[model samples]
Target: MADVLGLYNYWVVIFLMMTGFYIVISRRNLIKKVIGLSIFQTSVFLLYITIGKVRGGTAPIVADGFEVYSNPLPSVLILTAIVVGVATASVALALVVRIREAYETIEEDEIFEQDR
Candidate 1:
């Protein structure tokens, strides 16, 4: 029970990942797919933060009394990833807007049918 509770973050990550994947695959609306992708991206971010956490760890800085310093690389990388993810999501939404404008619909199946 203790072990399972300790890994709760991982369980949440798995749940979010699956839910996002399902939404992306099962939904026919392009907006829904984009939202699903954002959820999936959020799960990845949570997973990384969970992995980087350390018990009784201090910030990665030179201190006189601190010994167990947590590594900052993961957090730094995640920050950069968040910026990139936002840009990517914005671009995806912009494309979706353009697609909607061109096709007069945002449904994936409808768009495909129109193309056909």
Candidate 2:
């Protein structure tokens, strides 16, 4: 039970990831799909950050008293990913706006029906 409790964060990550994936796959609205992708991206970020955490660890700075220094690479990478994710989401939203303008509806099935 204690061992299972220790992995709570991982379990949360898994749940969020699956929920996001299910939203993306099952939703028909373009805006909803983008939201789902954002959720999925956020879960990935959480997973990476969680993985980077160290018990009894300090920041990766050289100090005489500190020995267990946490790695900074994962944090740095996540920062970059956050920037990219925001940009991608903005682009996706812009595309969705354009799609709504052209199709008069943001629903995937409606757009397809119009096309046909």
Candidate 3:
């Protein structure tokens, strides 16, 4: 039962990764693509968070007789990645907005046809 529960998070991570990838690839709208990108980023964040979890562990701060503590590195790295990911998503959405303004359509094929 413990092993099965532990594997649940892995399944979720895999599902999120695959769903994000599919959305990004199968969708044609710029806004939708951005949403998919965010999903992908969220999965990455979740992976880090899940990997950082430690059974019978406490916070990194000093405590009375608490010897087991989860590694803080993954969480720290995830925090940085989240910030960068937010920045990236903002930039991408901004670009999408600009494209919408210039082309009057958010669809990739529409933009291509308009360009031609």
Candidate 4:
């Protein structure tokens, strides 16, 4: 039962990642593309958190009477990645807003046309 639940969680993370990638690559709207990129980034965050989770491990912080501590490296890495992701998302969103204001439309093709 526990193994099945774990496998299911893994599958969900993979599905989210694939879907997010497909959206980012295939979508045409600028805002939609940013949304997709955010989703993809978040899916990666989820993956990191999932991997960091231990079946029966304790926190890495040294305290009183602690035996097994799960690895904290993954959590720390994910925290950094999440901050970077937010920065990227903010920049992308700002770019999309600028594109919309400049071209009067958020469609990728329209923006390209205005650029040319």
Candidate 5:
């Protein structure tokens, strides 16, 4: 029980990842697919944050008598990833809007059917 509690973050990450994957795989609506992609990205962000955390560690700032400092690299990388994800999501949604305009529906099957 103690170990399970200690690793709860990992469990949650796994659950979020699976849920997002399922949504993306099973849902045909363009907006729902975008939401799933966002959820998947969120799980990745949480995973990075969890990996960057150190027990009894201080921030990367140097101070007197601080021996353990968490690495700032992962956090920085995640920040960049977040920016890129937002940009990609916006573009994707824009495309979805165009798709809706062209096809009159956002469902994947409907879009393909209309394309035929």
Candidate 6:
């Protein structure tokens, strides 16, 4: 049962990644693109967290008599990645807003037409 649950979680993460990628590639709306990017970033974080989990390990914090600590590297890496993702998302959203203001529309094709 536990293995099945773990596998299900992995599948969900994979689906999130694929869905996010498809949205980013196929959507024409600037806001939708940013949303997709955010989704993709979040899915990666989920992957990291999932990988970090131990079957029966405890927290990595050192204690007087603790044993079998889960790896902390993955959590730290994911934290850093999440911060970077937020920064990237913010910049992308700002660019989208600027494009909308300049072109009077959020559609990618419309923005490209205005650019040309």
Cα lDDT tens digits for candidate 1, 1-116: 98998899999999999999999999999999999999999999889988887889987788898889776888998999999999999999999999999999999999999989
Error of 5 at 54 (Å): 1.0
lDDT of 6 at 65: 79
TM-score of each: 0.89, 0.89, 0.90, 0.82, 0.88, 0.86
Could you tell me how far off, in angstroms, the CA of residue 63 lies in candidate 4 after the best superposition? 2.5
Candidate of highest lDDT: 5
Estimate the overall C-alpha local distance difference test score of candidate 3.
Answer: 0.91
Sliding window of 10 residues with minimal summed lDDT for model 5: 107-116
Model 6 clashing-pair count: 0
RMSD for each model, in Å, please? Answer: 1.6, 1.6, 1.5, 2.2, 1.7, 2.0
Tens-digit lDDT track of model 6 for 1-116: 98897699789999999999999999999899889989988998998888888878888899877777888999999989989988988999899888778789999888788788
Ten-residue stretch with the least lDDT total in model 1:
65-74
- Lowest lDDT sum, 10 consecutive residues, model 2, at 65-74
Model 3: worst 10 consecutive residues (lDDT sum):
55-64
lDDT of 2 by residue, 65-114 (tens): 88897778889999999999999999999999999889899999999999
For candidate 3, lDDT tens digit of each residue in 44-99? Answer: 89998889889898877778999999879898999899999999999999999899
Which candidate, 5 or 6, has the higher TM-score? Answer: 5
State the C-alpha lDDT per candidate: 0.93, 0.93, 0.91, 0.86, 0.94, 0.89
A best-first ranking of the candidates according to their TM-score comes to 3, 2, 1, 5, 6, 4
Q: What is the lDDT of residue 97 in candidate 4?
A: 84
What total of clashing residue pairs does each candidate reach?
A: 0, 0, 0, 0, 0, 0
Q: Tell me which residue pairs clash in candidate 4.
A: none
